[model samples]
Target: QKEVEQDPGPLSVPEGAIVSLNCTYSNSAFQYFMWYRQYSRKGPELLMYTYSSGNKEDGRFTAQVDKSSKYISLFIRDSQPSDSATYLCATLPGGTSYGKLTFGQGTILTVHP
Candidate 1:
């Protein structure tokens, strides 16, 4: 099984809706979790990161991690058309793979106006 798995959701929602994205991992050694947003034809930009397990929120975006369940989630509130993009979940194992991120299959989101 892949270390990280995410639904490559072509998730569609109307404007102003709350959007939720999730990922699950099989590795317990992962110490850091991150979320990246990529626009069409552009590279992904880091949106959030958390060491271990906890919740972090920025503006309309929120990230949550549960080490016990090996699950993580990202939530976007009051979504907008500008938020249409691919979201990826990533993790750092902090061993020989230092500085490298194992990424999930990206989830695509579209917010319609």
Candidate 2:
């Protein structure tokens, strides 16, 4: 299996829906979990970062990690059309590979009017 897997969601939601995006990883050696948001052709912007397992919340975005299950998630509280973007989950391997990231294919999210 690939080290990481995620649905490439073109998930559409109404103006204030709660949106959930997720990914799964196979390697136990991954130490850092991160979420990134990208728009059009621009590079991704870091949205959340967590070491090991736990949850981190910032404004409309919340990220959760479960090391035991090798799963990670992102939750969007107040979805808006302006919030529409591709969400990518990434991880860095432990030890020497800690700075290098492996990314999921990314989920394309669209918040409709």
Candidate 3:
């Protein structure tokens, strides 16, 4: 089983709403984390990545990680319908095997206008 767990949400929100996505993991070995957004019929797109405990913001999106709690989060400000997609969280332990990653069951979100 994957070490990471997240709510498999078909989450719906109004346009301009603030949307929050979260994940938790049991593996203390995981040292790197990333979030991806996938649109229908398309491969997952890398949205953001975090390597340590802190918050990283890019425009309207924010990714936060707390290693002490083994928690990770993504927040979207002023959400838009274009944001509709399946979001995936990925984790990797720093090692030679960068190809090996544990992934959470994706959370689907739709922002309605």
Candidate 4:
């Protein structure tokens, strides 16, 4: 089984709605987690990064991690069409991995007018 799994949501929402995305990882050693947003045909930009457990919130976005369940989530409030993009969840297993990130299948989101 893959170490990390995400729904790759082609999720659609009306403008001004909240958008939620999630991922699960199997490796308990993973100590770093991240979320990236990528527009079509472009490289992804880091949206959130967290070490170990807990939550991080920035503006309309929030990231959460639960080490016990090996799950991570990203929440976007008052989403806009400009938020249309692919979201990827990634993790670093630490140790000899040297911060190499293992990524999930990106979830595609479309915020409609």
Candidate 5:
């Protein structure tokens, strides 16, 4: 199995819709989970970071990690057209390998105004 997998979704939602993106991984050695949002032609900016399994919330965004099932998720509340972007899930090995990340195929999201 690939270390990480995600549906490359071109998910479209109306403005103010809630959006959810998810990824699954097969590696138990992964200890860090991250969510990144990338605009066209721009490098992805880290949106969320979590150690092990838990949840983290930022304004309009919430990230969840479940180490047992190797699943991670990002939820966007009150979506906007400006929120349109590709969402990528990434993982890194714990300890010394934490700096190097392995990424899932990103999901494209479009929030229409």
Candidate 6:
């Protein structure tokens, strides 16, 4: 099975709604968690990241990690149409395996105005 798994959601929501994205992994070596946002025809950009198990919040975005369960999540508050994009959940094994990120299939989200 793939180390990281996410729902390929063509999820649609109205503007101003709260959005939740989730991913699960089976790899125990993964120590860092990341969420990337990719707009149409563009490379993914790092949206948020967290080390170990915890929650990291920045403005409208929140990233959470749970090591015990090997799960991660991203939450977006006050959604906007511009926020529509493909969001990917990624994990990296720390130490010598640096720079290697395993990504999920990505979930598509559209916030309609």
Cα lDDT listed for each candidate = 0.95, 0.93, 0.92, 0.94, 0.94, 0.95
Candidate 3 C-alpha lDDT tens digits along 34-104 = 99999999998999998878999999999999999999999999999999999999998866355587889
Which pairs clash in model 1?
none
Report the lDDT tens digits of candidate 1 across residue range 18-101. 999999999888989999999999999999999888999999999999999999999999999999999999999855445788
Candidate 6 residue lDDT tens string, 1-113: 89999999899999999999999999888888999999999999999989999999999999999899888999999999999999999999877455788999999999999
| Native-to-model Cα distance after best TM-score fit, residue 62 in candidate 3, in Å | 0.4
Per-model TM-score, in order, reads: 0.95, 0.95, 0.95, 0.95, 0.96, 0.97
Error of 1 at 89 (Å): 0.4
RMSD (CA, Å), each prediction = 1.3, 1.1, 1.1, 1.1, 0.9, 0.8
lDDT of 5 by residue, 1-113 (tens): 67999999889999999999999999898989999999999999999999899999999999999988889999999999999999999999888533889999999999999
Better of 3 and 6 by lDDT: 6
Task: Name the 10 consecutive residues with the lowest summed lDDT in model 1.
Answer: 92-101
Each prediction's number of clashing residue pairs? 0, 0, 0, 0, 0, 0
lDDT of 4 at 9: 69
- Judged by whole-model lDDT over C-alpha atoms, candidate 5 comes out at 0.94
lDDT of 3 at 38: 94
Query: What is the TM-score of candidate 3?
Result: 0.95
Model 6 Cα shift for residue 77 (angstroms): 0.3
Give stretches of model 3 more than 4 Å off. none
Q: What TM-score does candidate 1 reach?
A: 0.95
Angstrom error of the Cα, residue 45, model 2: value is 0.9
Best candidate, TM-score = 6
In model 3, what are the clashing residue pairs, if there are any?
Answer: none
As a TM-score, model 6 comes out at 0.97
